[model samples]
Target chain A: MKKSVILSILSVFLITIFLGGCGSKDQTTLNVYNWGDYIDSSVIKQFEKETGIKVNYDTFATNEEMYVKINKGNASYDIAIPSDYMIEKMIKEGLVEKIDFNNIPNYQYIEDRFKNLEFDPTNEYSVPYMWGTLGILYNKKMVDEPVDSWDILWNPKYEKQILMLDSQRDSLAVALKKLNYSMNSTNDAELEAAKNALIEQRPLVLAYVGDEVKDKMIGEEAALAVVWGGDAVTMHRENPDLEYVIPKEGTNLFVDSIVIPSTAKHKAEAEKFIDFLCRTDIAFKNTDYIGYSTPHMEARKQLDPELANSPIAYPEPEDLENAEIFIDLGTYIEQYNRVWTEIKSH
Target chain B: MNKKWISAPYLVWMVIFIVVPLFLVGFYGITVRTDTGFVFSLEPLQRCFEPTYLKVLGRSVLLAAISTVICLILGYPIAMILTSKDFSDKNIYLMLFVIPMWMNFLLRTYAWLTLLEKNGLINVLLQKIGLNPIHILYTNQAVVLGMVYNFLPFMVLPIYSVLKKLDSSLIEAAQDLGANGFQTFIKVIFPLSIPGVVSGITMVFMPAVTTFVISRLLGGGHYYLIGNLIEEQFLSVGNWHFGSALSIFLMIIILISIFITSHYETDKEGSVGLW
Candidate 1:
């Protein structure tokens, strides 16, 4: 009985290995890595149906998590949707491939304003996917005062009723902007003040949250939260009592863009996928479902007029005048890490 | 089939998955990368001893120790009750403890969030009962509660198995010698169960100290445990050297704890008996 069992097991293992070797022989598979819940599932099905290319879709929670995986060179990811700062970092490190814009004719649908940004100044390495501003999402019933300025977050009456972003850069940016300093300030004194401000505000924060900020704000678990404009849009849909505001002081204007890593084996197919995502109907489907601001002008027009005109989703230029895009901090990131650790440990 | 051949696949799996990763972690822990190449450096390990990190390590140990003790206090009685001769439905009661564990650990923890949030079910129930709602979530207490709830099974199963195999003749001899129930438990049963208790504490304490999720979900990110510090280094900061160093240091602490507990477990002379 034992001999027969061993023989069967060995045969099964050999058969599995043989089948796995044959499975990838003929098919052109594209590996797409994106943020969790960033895409509409139907779009992937449609793309596969139209192109007959198999897609291995995976998701990451943060830009850092995605960076480490790609940097390790363990997996050959064909496409990645990383934010502007990360694209800049990847480009500097020679990790990303320059896009062949000729293959991406749908790239013209992207707004001109989203192009020629600081991260990819020549617009060579990446194509804009979505863009938004970081701001405060507050409950109208919980607070009685005007919520226009970042100063309101420091109000003592809202103690233990505020939720700060758990992310280091975003949280520090809020403090930096509130002090009338640049969000990208690397100076010791400026960062020290930001650190001190966060340490003081730590007592007032109910929780340092990430994706849970939306659920908590909608449930009225917290009166105020630091959230991305996109998340704020989703939270408002769930609870109309919630309101989003771009603080008058300034905020981080972030743009997530699609880039092909240099390690990608299927570059041409990845470019095709990027063009598919940029198409008007597909872009509209994604932006509508994901609730992020669409950088595709045609897609924006196709959205509900109420949503298309909403200042939260599509903030006017003057409102973004003070907003600064985050840049790769290089080794200066250690300082922010230190300050964050101190604040969290304290 | 030969025994060695039968175990060959498992041995390969262990070396590839366990030994190789551990070796890599150790390599990164003690080395620093520089302009030329990797060099032997203790900076990452030394950084772990800094005041901030030391406090994080101290908090992790303190909370894990608290949770282990709570599990022991609660679990011992349950194991004793289940192993008692009068308990006829022991399997049914044991199944009750194991059932929740069959569900995903993350899902179970997430469920607690719904019950513990500000306007969550617990608060709603409290308000309806004319009692002020308690702020129990997002606190160290909640983290400890989560640890105890999740790890109680680990503590109970080992003790229950030990007690089940305990010789009945020993108890009968103590009773024949005119010893009462309390005296018999203190002098005979408790000392004999030292191995089980030691293993139980080891299982519960080790995981509790290294748990990032429970503290993250329950402690509201306010309580920065060592696990969270290590996680931030690896995931957010991309500082693998520091993260590996922290992991190595945590492993050493766990090894020392297991060493101490195993010493008690091997002292079969009944030296652990209460006088």
Candidate 2:
């Protein structure tokens, strides 16, 4: 008798979920997948309120995670934000749809220079969302001298107080640049050298972290961290003692852009949302809130001169002299994986 | 026989959730897709025997074994004290032990990060006491500490239940037979509780062996256990084939350990002889 009762209760729960799933098909919704903490959520509220289309926003920590989700094709996302090399891979793999610029009047607001980049050279598939430099974020009080190069990361004085990015590509890129090799070096000797550099630096590193770098730096848990320019700006706001610099050895310049996956069920609504985000006012709000470099010319002009002129946010041309954007490594990524594994295991 | 129908939902759930996924993992583990079509390949399995990966597997086993041993040492005493009739406020003490388990395991592990960080609470306390702060976070020690902290309750609960049910007459008889307190415990209580100890060790060791989050957060990515290696293959490298092979490899290790533990649990004469 008790088993019968439990069976009936389980049936009731399953039926409830099945019926609830069927009921949600009537409402129009656009799913937007972006990196964690990438957006000003207030804009999502405004977009939903104005468009009468429900917005289902989701977050991922890395491009690889986003790729796996999209590759699985389980949940249909109307829009996604992926980085430069990933965008290239998605285009080659036929995973994304080309944007209809005619539907997006605000495309004119995007700066000309942001257009026709190597990732989307034809300006067909993606719209630049946010761009930034991979650099060092150091606490002024903890360091004895000026922190302008990647060499400081290897300095024994700051032993056990250094935090490195946990990402394979970014961390490997740091070691590569520090050794005066190309960030995209595929040669075995260069890769091995980079691996050894990291293995040597491992003892001094406090931790390899991802998004937690911001909080740890803010809490004064680490003396230095390798972080993106945008997170550095956000962290600096929370703690003025923190400073950001693109090291003299050079670093990665990454651009994350908005694109629609081909599997999108709500193409029109997705386009509308993209255009809404690109509106000068909306774009300015996001740029200001996220503290990332904006690609919208009108939005950039609207920013405070102090912020727009800040070296960290808008570095002079010389600071970018050695910086290189990451390209899709394609099959060569396996080599990177092996080298990273070696470094980590060693 | 009619009552057996009540388990239908659970059987269906298992087929869909467990059996199907396992089949998929097995399918991917031994095959690779080529430009033409799918091909049977032992490459993924062969890669698992690489010296580098073998070393990682050894490290994972070592760390997990250490944590399991530590949990046994710590948990056995607590279980004993709790099950003791002479102890007062046993319920309250058990409740206190279980409070940390009530919080999410990830949150509990993260709390350790806050406490063990160089400039964190533990360091601050050390400074207050006029002692130099120790760097414990992001080390093998910290990873082991995390495993023990998270899985200690798993060890305690099972042993505690068994000890609570233990017949005191056996102890009394041992005393009557001229066995002292330590002798009674060694020959009688410990042997009788082998089942619980086996279960607790299994519970602690399994999760400790397979955990990626603790090693990622506490080991600082410098230390790559088998769990971390598997995670890297699947998540970052996007090589599901190799990841599935590694997972199968891990399952075999766990199954072997469980077998060894159960052997000790069942062999009453063999275990009691050790005393």
Candidate 3:
């Protein structure tokens, strides 16, 4: 009797292993890699139902993590959404495939302003997905003074109540902008000044945070934080006391775009997914759900009137005059790394 | 089935998962790609000794040691209590200790974020009692608390097993020899449990030293431990050579620690047996 029971258990385990291996072998599967919490789940289901193609989705916390995986030639990802500078780096390194444009007919709905940017000069390699400016996200209840500039972050009165981005580029950009230098400055003197400024500001900082900035800000854990525009919008929805400002000193303007990796096994299916996302109604749903600015012109018109006109979501041209987009720094990234390590270790 | 043949699958698994990976880490640790090709270089390994990196290493060791000591202090008494003759329903207590571990470690740590937040459950309770809410999250104390809470089971289990198997006649003999309770514990029970203590310390210290998540979640990215430094190098900076070198340095530290602990364990046994 014991032997039969053991044999039954072994058979059950073997059946599970065999069945697990037999998942939708005949269907085309499109593997998508994107930023964490960047997409609506229902969209994936809609795409799958409409196209009859199985979708395998993955999320990455940072662009660098996605880049490392693709660069290593380890994973076969059909689509990836990386920031502008990283897209440029991947294009230079020949890690991405140029879109045929023939397959993505809905691309016409993309705004002309987002086209032919420095990242992809001819708009050959990527499709603009989301764009936003980096700025200070502050709680109005915590601070009494007007919050216009980055200097307020260094005020000793707000000591241990300020949070900074843990990312090297974003945090360094804040310090550089505060010093009245270009956010992308690679000059030794300017970079050193930025590094020193960060070191000086470190003591007052409660923490260097990433995605948790939204939660902490909403919980009133910190009075001030450096956050992206989209995250600031999300936090505002949660807590009405929060206010976002683009500092007078200027800040980093960024665009995250979708691209097909060179190692893609289903380029056609990936293109189909991209075109589906670019459709007006689908793009509206995504932009509204994720709380980021969309580059789709038709989708912009479809959004709520208040949100479509919000200065934070759709800033005027004059507001963006001082905003600078991040460009691929090439080997100079090492210098930034050294300075960041110094600041962190100190 | 022959015993040697039965071990074949595990041998293949070890080579593929353990030995090959270690060889690759060592290779990456000592070499750098250049115009000429992948050439041998000590620069990456030597960089591990730089002041900034050394400080990170020192901080990691200090925090891990603190957590291990705390675990030992808390775990020993629990183990003893569970194994005591007067104790009842020991299995239920053991089950309670093991239950939280079945949940994901990351989820457990994430739960702490909610409990320790400014407007979280702990602060809400404090406010109810008219006490000032404490800001304990995102501090070194929180990080150490996470480490001790997660690793206390490793300290408790081995010591419990050793004490359970211990001969009760030894205790009876010590009592008959007119030794008091404290003297009996010090001379007999504690000395015999040194092996379990050593294993427990090794298990707790190794994982504590290598953990990046607890520090990242609880330390609020304020503390740059060695694990975080390595993670930054590989993930953020794209510097695998330096990361591999740091990993190798950590492995050496762990090896040295295990060797010292085992040596101490055997030394204690020899002295106690002679007594």
Candidate 4:
């Protein structure tokens, strides 16, 4: 019995010693957290080659997920890519740190159109990475009609073949747009209208989708989808029959911006990477790979003409007039999420 | 031979796995704050009772109840057959039932997703059979199908064990007393299988009620559940207190289920406590 006890104690000690050795901490490694499939990873390798900062990249599905990781105070991410409303919300809570413009010389390459947006006035806290609208993408073969309106998604004809956005903000924005309501409306009556519209459309929806809609739609599994412009671009890349169209009614124009969360230890390295991403060539590469429109004017010129010409990638200025940026709803966000939950559960 | 040996190890395991986590859950439940930086309160609990979470709870109970009923009805006969005298290779049949449980539950769920999905094998086969390719995925039916498939093995194992231990003489005596096969089964076999049924129901129903992954992948993530609420609170919204409260709420519901199911069995099983 003593021998067995000794053996067990020895085993435990050896295992603890070996496992403890694996917990190595180094100051050189910069941990980056961003949206999944958001950035071209090749650019990260290039940045690593240029500067010997070992970059550990991780991805989250939503802005709130990133916020949870940062705010909960476990993960120490150097850089974060959150959208406009999230940026505003983070800024309000002082969860983001001010950017030092001197570190990022290539910030000048970013287009004036994307700069000084409402989320980050004077581009102080965040840099615009990529921007796009939420819209309809349908198969040209299956959908013979012009498919100009959001109402087409509500039609009974495509009952089992329709895909809607799964994200709370994007999905809710679409519903709000369908009812001719403001994308950022915090009013209860307008929200109720959107909720009722969603409930009506629920029976007709095939799936509430995120990135997977791209693959499922092109494969003809789903005939019509409410997808992000970036995902629509990716789907169209593989299949030429796939066509993306903005609903005649307006949609939410969103910009995902790179910001340093308050918990960042490597703010210097993050700022440098953001600067690297802003370089016209790098931005163009990222845009080409990820299929999101680069917010840089110089990058637009460098983009392939086919991509540049796609209305889905870059809508005309007239089509853009009615598009509104999402604003932080503050206290009303709870109500919005509640409404979202109620609509979904029922 | 030795109750102490069994009791000691069982107690140790319970303390390590169940009791420890439950204590931590209580610790986190009161300590973690809401997104607005407020400390633990009844606010999250109040939020949980809101129509949104209640509807989620309602759907979860509905899906779980239906799945339990379906599994028992399907699993009982298969378990009975496996335990029957006609089946010579009991070990082989038992292993066959047990083997599918060895695969990851998530992978099994995904396999069903592949089957239920549009352009999946089912739809393709339907088209081949000259029938209209039906829309099966992202519906309540798909969610129930996933639950039944995943929990069917769980339902089978308990009933098989009980039926295997069933005395042959009891059924024979029922037959000798002028009862037909159907009457013998109803009077002896079916009544004797209640413990197994109760245990199987307990196992499948609890997991089903709290399950969100299967529903998310198969039902398209639109159908929110209490499990989803807990996930959103802890992982998404960073409200650990709320998540803990939600978990405790699930635990209370589970306890209530056990109490109700136990009461159902008590009237029938008199002295035989289902172990």
Higher-DockQ candidate of 1 and 3: 1
Candidate 3, superposed: residue stretches over 4 Å from native? A1-22, B269-275
TM-score of chain A of each: 0.92, 0.92, 0.93, 0.91
Write the residue-wise lDDT of candidate 1 on A1-346 in tens digits.
Answer: 1222233355457546755877755878888888877888799889989998877777676788789889974899999999988899999999999999999999999999999999999999999999999999999999888899888889999999999988888899999999999998989999999999999998888998877777789899999999999988888999999999999999999999999999999999999999999999999999998889999999999999989999999999999999999999988989999999999998
Tens digit per residue, CA lDDT, model 2, A1-346: 1222233355457546755876766668788898877788789889868877877777777788788889864889999999999999999999999999999999998878789999999989999999989999999999869988999999999988999988889999999999999998878899999999999998899888888888789999889999999888889989999999899999899889999999999999999998998999999999999999988988889998878888888888799999998988888888998988887887
Using lDDT, give the best candidate's number.
1
The residue-by-residue lDDT of candidate 4 on A1-346, one tens digit each, is 1222233355457546744786655536677877777777688789878987767776777777778888876888889899999999999999999999999998888888889899888679999999998788899999989988899988999887898877778888888888888989989999989888999999888887666676688788888998889888899888888988888788889999999988888888988888988988899899999898888888989888988878889999887777889999987887787777777788
Backbone clash count, each prediction separately: 0, 0, 0, 0
Q: Which candidate tops DockQ?
A: 1
| Candidate 4 Cα errors over 4 Å, as ranges | A1-27, A45-50, A279-281, B1-43, B46-52, B85-96, B165-184, B187-192, B235-244, B264-275
Cα displacement (angstroms), candidate 3, residue A86, comes to 0.7
Q: Candidate 4 lDDT (Cα, whole model)? A: 0.83
CA deviation > 4 Å runs, candidate 1: A1-25, B1-3, B269-275
- Looking at model 2 chain A, which ten-residue stretch has the lowest summed lDDT? A1-10
2 or 4, greater by DockQ: 2
The models' CA-based lDDT, in order, is 0.91, 0.89, 0.89, 0.83
Q: Which portions of model 2 show Cα errors greater than 4 Å?
A: A1-24, B273-275
DockQ ranking, high to low? 1, 2, 3, 4
Give the Å error, residue A219, model 2.
Answer: 2.0
Report the poorest 10 consecutive residues by lDDT, candidate 1 chain A.
Answer: A1-10
